[model samples]
Target: MTMNKIYSWQHKLWNKLTHHADSGANALLLKGRAGIGKLDFARHFAKFRLCETPSSTSEACGTCLSCGWFEKGGHPDFYHVSPETSANFSGEAAVAVDRDESAGRIKSKKKTSQQISIVQIRALSDFVYMTGHQRGRRIILICPAEAMNAAAANALLKKLEEPPAHVLFILVAHRPQQLPATIRSRCQLINMPMPDVVQATRWLKQQGVNEPEACLAAASFAPLLALTFNDQRYAAQHDAFIEQISASRKINPIELAEKMQQSDLPIVVSWMQKWCYDLLCFCLTGKVRYHLSRMTTIRVLASSIENKALAAFLRTLLVSQQLARHPLNPRLFLEEIFIKYATLLDSNGVKRSS
Candidate 1:
């Protein structure tokens, strides 16, 4: 359940967390931008806490009962929560009613549109307060913890303030700032940054990604996005997005956003991130080797911008990405970005025919 290959820094942190030598925080909050091996790290931590014979100097033995259940993903004492709006699945997963000693598993591909509800939090609280099912402590992992609605947050806050003994909570979040102040104050924050391209490249290759460079090009070193980028399901759609941006060069920003909403937004944002990274790489390296998803497009893109301009474009891309998440109209957000990108390229004396 741990990263098959752990990096040096990750290994150091893993050691402290496992051995509890870094003992200031009972609850560890692993927060980071998307795709920095946080999930993998969390998995490793959970496995160690649930280890039947947690040793001082070695990783968990796969032969143990707890490790076996972890591999099977059937351990009742371990709980992992994720966002209700998770793209990996169609619905939300959470604890069962009353958090009573009930056995519920993380359900992906669920179509229900429920957020982490108050009931789920109550169940979690009760479960943590109850006795452990095994010899060690019970572990609760609430990921993308910001996705919890108001009621759920309140319920969770109470538990965080007075968590039961031998119950460990690991909260994973892409944006910790979005969490309640109480929640943030109650736990220890661990920053997980995005991996460098070299680290990313190595990890991708280890994942058996044949075209790891291409995946990197397509995802801007966001490992989970790169993982999803291995296929071409959204390739055509990205092309369509480029076409939309190209055609919106002179259009009003708001109008442009509406027109740009015809394609899948998440995938487009991912590409935009990759392109920004590629433009930066090109500006520095004078070569574009990693952006294989649209190497030709990036090559053309690189020739048109200086490093400053590329940085600005990346900023706009970040704006677009954040705006894509707000309750704002998606179309307007998309159009604004497309227009801005087109304007940037055009001002740089590079024009793509609409």
Candidate 2:
């Protein structure tokens, strides 16, 4: 299988990183917001560096022996480490990791952790010290570096401290601030920039997404995430969701919760947060952000909403977002959220606490 190509916007950054591959930096941290393709860029760069004979553009020759192993995710010199919940971890890689676990390693019967554990990091550290299966550069890619717990981060820190020769560490992180100062200071930071609206929309359209502008807006103008929303049919549902919430007085919490049960709770909560944000924007500046096409609806809703109540609801959604990954009855969670939203339009102007 061929690796997914990096987005067009990442070309310059890719070239710069590839040029620095020979600069002898052992650790590189790519930090940015979601959907900017940092991991994809890192993957392509790693392939290029590992390729016995790469193309003129410093891209991997897909037919090379090294490229074939990388594509199959069986490259002996490449380690792709991520949390189980991360989208970046392929099913094949998951199986391979399980198969390669040592007999002395502690095993857990419970679900694979969503976090990158100390065990995984320790194993990776050991792997890097062992003889390579091939005589070329070795690379370890750890995505969402924030997922590492205190122990795991400390374990990784050791590797960063005593740097290995001919080995490169690519750490892709969505939230760099979550990483410890010690861990962060050891690696070179690369800030991935968000693509402009025109570029984002054009790329989104090329992927055959409908209402690309609206989808991009809903995703905070992140093209890759916009494509995901479109693929999952969330973009189409967003308009109807906004319409439902705009009519806050008639909102049915149970019905709305049931309708959105299929969607991820965090995503649903995020959409609610964005809607409330737009309401506040309209209330303050008579303008909108995410829901640009719903200016009239937003303005009317903002007018009817009690400012205090809306503010409280917005704070409630923030808390909800934090708990989205935890165990919860999705329907009950959504119902409670929608119920609070309903009260925002109440004539009594009552503020509720979570």
Candidate 1 on 1-354: residue-level lDDT in tens? Answer: 134445544776776666763374667889876555676677677777777886658577767888887767667777766544232210123322111001111121224433566766776755676677786478888766765777888888888788777777888776687788889899888876667778788887877777877777655566655655564544445555554443423545565566555444544565566656766887687666544555566666667666687688888776565434332555666766666676676777643332
- Cα error, residue 225 of model 1, in Å, equals 3.4
| Minimal lDDT window, size 10, model 2 | 98-107
Clashing pairs in 2: none
TM-score of 2: 0.78
Among the numbered candidates, top TM-score falls to 2
Off by over 4 Å in 2: 1-4, 85-113, 236-263, 306-323, 326-354
Q: Indicate which candidate wins on lDDT.
A: 2
